[model samples]
Target chain A: MKTNKTSRAAQAFEKSLAARPTGRYVLRLFVAGATARSRQAVLRVRQLCEAELKDNCTLEVIDIYQQPNLARDNQIVATPTLIKEFPRPVRRFIGNLANITGLFVELDLGAKGKIAV
Target chain B: MKNNRPKSTSPVVHLPKCPTGIQGLDEITGGGLPRGRPTLVCGGAGCGKTLLAVEFLVRGAVQFGEPGVFMAFEETEAELKANVASLGFDLAGLVQRKKIVIDYVHIERSEVQESGEYDLEGLFVRLNHAIDSTGAKRVVLDTLEALFASLPNEAILRAELRRLFRWLKDKGVTAVITAERGRDQLTRHGLEEYVSDCVILLEHRVYDQIATRNLRVVKYRGALHGTNEFPFLIGDEGISVLPITSLGLNHKISSERIATGIPRLDAMLGGRGFFRGSSILLTGTPGTGKTIVAANFAQAACRRGERTLFFSFEESPNQIIRNMHSIGLRLEPLVKRGLLRFHAARPSLYGLEMHLATMFKEIVTFQPDVVVMDPITSLMDAGTASECRAMVTRLVDYLKAGQVTSLFTSLTQGGHALQQSEASMSSLMDAWLLLQDYEGNGERNRVLYVLKARGMAHSNQIREFLISDHGIDVVDAYIGASGVLTGSARAAQAALEKAAVLASQQEAAQLKREVERKRAALERQISGLRSDYETEAMELRRIAEQVGTRTFVLGTERAASGILRQADAKVAVGTRGKPGHGRRN
Candidate 1:
């Protein structure tokens, strides 16, 4: 029953993303220090924004080591976390973005068809 | 022997501790949790682990002049504030005053899709930021076990948790890490393995359908702490652990004495009554007036202008007041005057620990000079014998330490077991008064005697305990060859003695009258004899006169015959002398 509800909500979100393809996307990626994992997460999120939203997306990379207050104010609990801030329902994606397909589906970017890893 | 050898050679250096400022927790932990180190607090569901951690932070922030940071993983800041608000902790106010900072770590497993290896650097960063912002000396990571559920990879999670604890230690801030208890291990996620400097276990156990919360210091490295499980209560103020067993017998004793309300009962207790600040045990059988004795004690304390608190387990406050009124114990007036306070509750309302905690709270708030627990045996029924005895010991110790005289009424069953059952508790009391029913003459009568009174000369003789409209009257019980008598038997013996005395007095009065009559008869006999003698003498005198006159007349005719009959005048005078000499003979 939980999977069914999520699938229906995902379908609705996909339709809305398709309807407003030109709508601006605001994203924030929080990382800790200059670690390899943090660097990979930041690169992957920037790549997704440049490839998918092109000129309409604004991506901000924040290192919690430098601006630790942002981490406290934003309620960040895990490194390599990506937050879709501008969307009506702000969503958080935690951990390294290795599974590009799952990330696309989580971010509701599947309405633009499957993207190449 | 190896462990003891080192201690004998060198003095042990005490570990620096942070005081929790909690009622008894600090004492149990020998001070608070180890300073500047992470202490693992593990417990099962609804065991108050979260509350204990939160209170550590709140108390540190408000009381110790130390700022704190509360990082809640299970609850948000709003929820945490609202939850602690009921305990009279103004979390929002503390946060606004810059004394505390609350950072809520929201973790939703469904929202987070773990795709690759991730670290908990985010939590570390947030905690570090909160500490730096408020210069917090204390930090609480409430239930870090949520990370096990939020993050999928256990290997990375364990590694990160280990690092987090080490980092918290390096920061030099006292931290409390809460975790869920496991089936066999101390914590479900092996959190205790990481935070091993100190570990506290909280348990919520139900015994005989009553639940009691207990806290135990499972392990503390380089520090001594109470090893026994201490019962704790979450009251209006917060969690208060009862470190009762650890209390020493070193309370300051008061030499003052307080009356027991009944003057005769006081007279039996060395003319002054129970020692002030002493624990008095009043044990009796059913319907032997245990509550009456306790009520009398409370009234006496109140009359002396000392505050008295009455804890009734078997009856309501109003019911006790009404019943005492029948015996002329005016408790309502004392209650109205605020000198007496009554706290009434059912014995089965809660666990023994809760009841004890509530009593402690009442005693602290009322600050009474004397406390009376009516029928404490009923409260004893709420727990095992050992638990009840331990609770009573703690209560007695607490009252004595504060110089508050305490009176505990225990209801015992009929027969010899009364002394046997009270043997454990009676040792703790400074004075023990035994009230029992003497079944004789087809009636049961109440009798009281001072079984023991330490440091004072108390009467060993039993007194007939009488309850009348004018209050308790302690009269001397009849102890004779027929045995101890009370009630109607005592009255009858007194009447019999009075009757014997009256009979003996009447017999003495009758003998006095007889002696008076005998004296009167003797006097009458003597007077009659005297009169007879007088008459005889007068007749003799008249005959002599007649003889003289006849002799004189005959002498005229025949003077010689009269003279011969009467003789010469000198001869007659000589005859008179001869008659006088004859009468003298």
Candidate 2:
């Protein structure tokens, strides 16, 4: 499980590196430890950054258990909280990132073609 | 911790407690909130729930030397600091000193979207980090119910909250969690369900347009606590809860006596005065000089270099000073000297509890040796009769505990009701002086007498209470066949008595003069009779001489006076001898 987490973290880092600098969306996902829900939220946000907003998003996932100070500084109350840091306006999404359309609409991302589940 | 246990038949395992350092709060909670556990403090909006939580943390940090972490869900750090600063809490200073750490948890529902299962591990992490950074032994989550409004999933929130409480318990830091009062439950979000070791409910109630804040401990899992609603107020320092019946009757008493300002009045009261550290009740009818008596007592106390505090419910401080000045009581000088303080407020200014709290505050701040409440009956109008009695009882108990002498003036309507109204309060007093009005002989007079004086031989004679420019003077009221006479009637009676004495004195003098004249006349008459008797004796002597000469001439004149005298003597001797012989025969 530890190796899998490291590999996923590396993939997300590569994806953010490949994203273009211009009009890039800066995002941070706050999750608790290595729970399945945290893993799902991490995977979902990374997939959205890669599939929908390709080469235009930088996503960083932080485990509150590992970096509790950051959680305190950001006032993170719920786990799996996704924060849009660099967009013109800061926004936050709590809970697992399950509904893609709803997330896209709330993030002010223009309505795009529906992606297959 | 073991010393805090009650000596009862229950098991001896005592619950450890963390002192809140709030006045009168620790006594009510038996020590304080259950230690190393989350206690729920629920109240309605603007009911001082947040302030209580903040005070708990601040007191813990500052007074108990226990570093605290305040995690505010409703207010930010700046806002909380500004809010508590009004109560004189130096939040910024505490924060800078590393004694307290404030973590403002901001969760905006409109700016967030919930998609799936979530836990409050983030909160746990933040709380843990804040506590660890400051090495805090105390934590406060002010109004954690804000999460219920921010989080959409109740099932997940409840589970996370439960786990969060369990985690906090395991962490072993005493925590205070504030929640909004619910309609049918202890908290709006049922936060009490999880943080159930102790629950404190704060209520703000209005009676007769006056508001009173009350606090009650609803439950304590393994401890004994006060279940009655105690009145609490947010004073300049912080929140102070007043436990009505907590003060026991085991105060050290003083045997020293203090004089009433009126010398004669003091004479009426055991010749010395009221016992030190005793509760004195002064009851009177309207315009019967109750305030004057109270002022006298206060002045006497001040003169003795004792700090005196006078609470006037009907008059302002300036008015009392001016009025007392008219009666020759110069309280201003004593006040300037700081030995006397006058606190005046209308009875209707606030609720009875508020007045009591203010009085307690004043007594504490001044630490006066003597406290005088001028016309305490006016305060009865602010609350029920029973409430007034309870207030008096608590006040007396408090004053006694501090070894303070208290004098309470009660205004009676008049007539027989005078004793009836003060019957309830008089029992708590060590000395009770009653001032009454006597209306007769076309005048009204004030009379004073000691009705009761415990542990002292007090006078039962009613004295005519006189208030003049020189102050109070108690004189004996005239008790004659016409009943008790006062005012002009007493003076008239005195005058009549004087006149009767004078008339009797004059008649005795006149009879003495007549006896002197009669004796003088009798002496003159005796002198006249003596002169007449002397003249008659002289004439008799001359006649005898002539008779002797004539008898001598007639008996050949002479040989005469002697011969005539011899013959006469012989005749007289013969007559006497014949009379004696006849008597003998």
Candidate 3:
């Protein structure tokens, strides 16, 4: 009876681990309008996600002028703000997202120290 | 093109105002801040900008019955409540009662990083929610400059800050936005040029190592305001800004007289005393009984059932009470009865502005009929001479406007600059009493003289100010050959005058007796001569009678013999005798 209980507990732990998504990213970008900075931020974030995150990431770009409620709900005090929503410990960065190297380092998906758990 | 013309000729409309409910502030502001408009209150760090803003909101809620919302960007709600608790503002209670709300908008710079352009719609939503929750009529953004330091986007923050102010105006809420004072502009980001309606600048400056907080109305779009810098104080109560220039010389003048507690001194002031609302100055040298005189005035005011506030800079309250005990002024009883209040502090404890502000606050709270500042000269120790003068002038003006009798004691150093500084505020005084130490005949005496009393006839003579175990005594000025005499010299001179008068009286009596003796002698001689003449006449008459009788008898015997010859001889001798007698007579 004890062997049977231990085997079932191990099987449940393996099943929970298999259900977790691997190397997947979820993001939300907030912008004021289609200004130069906002456009550049959208383009840079899209390029980063396609190149680095590929099909594993889902990105939602919100224009504050059109969707001010969503922006306000998230406390978006500045425009072109990006929020990492998935893969535990959500993070936020406020910029045009043009500095890809600094962005990768801040996103924690660099060559080393990528989020493992 | 159509020329726009008015349909009717109506009077010009003016901007509405909301009263701040602050002492002297509303007067200087002509009413208060422009209603339904944004007012920028910018000041340096710890210069009372936040206090002023919070006070604006709290007063609106409490005094005006208008609800308010305080969206703090710097301090938390609990911190603000604790901070204003000392000011007697129960913000938590107001919040619970739904009369006001304090929403602290905390922005953690480390938790969030700026990526691109965004607006402060979150702050607006939260502020709007608070205002709606209480239907607030007033709103305060305390230390809005904290956002510039917290947030990374300056251009967007500036734009949003402008929009926020405009939005508050659109909401028809009288808003107060506090900002940190900038180097050259009224605000760090030049918020003054954007605010436009009104701009108030507060400064905490250290002059001569003493810090004083001053407030000035930099710009009021369409209102007339006092442009001078006014001193403010943040004490147990909230901010109290003294609008020194708001009060003109239009205060009501009282003709009622109040005693100086010294009967003789009152007599010197034309059988009355200081005017009920007059400003009296007592200037003296060190240890010349200036404090004693001020204490006497306070005692007199309290004895008359009027409240009195005594501000002692050189001595503590206990020291004053104990020292005044020797002079028989029982201030402790009046203090117990709540008629007399003693606020003693060192002159160096605060700047002159702070001292004035504290005095003003106490006066308002105590509502005293009389205020006595013992040794106002100590105020010069806290500030420059000119600054002290300005502070004193404002104090006098405030007291005069309230029709509260005020007494100021000053110490003169007996030199040119000291004299100039001593009489610095004499011109503002309605009555000036000068005390001096008269050193004569190897002793020093306290002498008091009324230097000036406007609109009333006061004694110009200096009196001997005697403070004994009984009370203050003002003896009559003794004028001798050596100018004015006081102390033992006066008594000695008075005794000499009495002796001289007595000696002159004795001399006049002696001369009168000699003249009476000479007159009696001349009268006795005349009487003796008259008596002798009378006796001689009587004897002559008697001899003539006897001779006549004898002659008659002899004539009768001889006339018979030779009648004819005798008759002829007798007629001739009688005629000759009669002619000689008539000629001799």
Of 1 and 3, the candidate ranking higher by DockQ = 1
> How high is the lDDT of residue B187 in model 1?
91
Model 2, B1-585: lDDT tens digits are 446556677767778899999888898998898999989888887778888988998999888999999988878899989989999999999999999999989887877777777788898889998889899999898877788888888888888888888888999999888888999998877755456688999998876667778899998889999999988888888898888767788999899988887888778777898899999998988899988888888888889899999998988888888998997889899999999998989899888888998998899999999999988898878877887898899999999999999999998988887798789999999989888889997889999888999999988898998889989888999998879999899999999999999999999999999999999999999999999999999999999999998655554533334354565654555354444434433
Count of backbone collisions in candidate 3:
9
CAPRI docking class of candidate 3:
incorrect
TM-score of each: 0.81, 0.84, 0.74
* Interface RMSD to the true structure, each candidate: 1.4, 1.1, 3.9
Ranking by DockQ: 2, 1, 3
**Best candidate (score: DockQ):** 2
Residue B299, candidate 1: Cα error in Å is 3.0
Per-residue lDDT of model 3, residues B77-107, tens digit only: 8999998898898888988899988877665
| Ten-residue region with minimum lDDT total, candidate 3 chain B | B576-585
DockQ computed for model 2 against the true two-chain complex using alpha carbons: 0.55
Arrange candidates, best TM-score first.
2, 1, 3
Backbone clashes for every candidate come to 1, 3, 9
Clashing pairs in 2: B552-B557, B552-B558, B553-B557
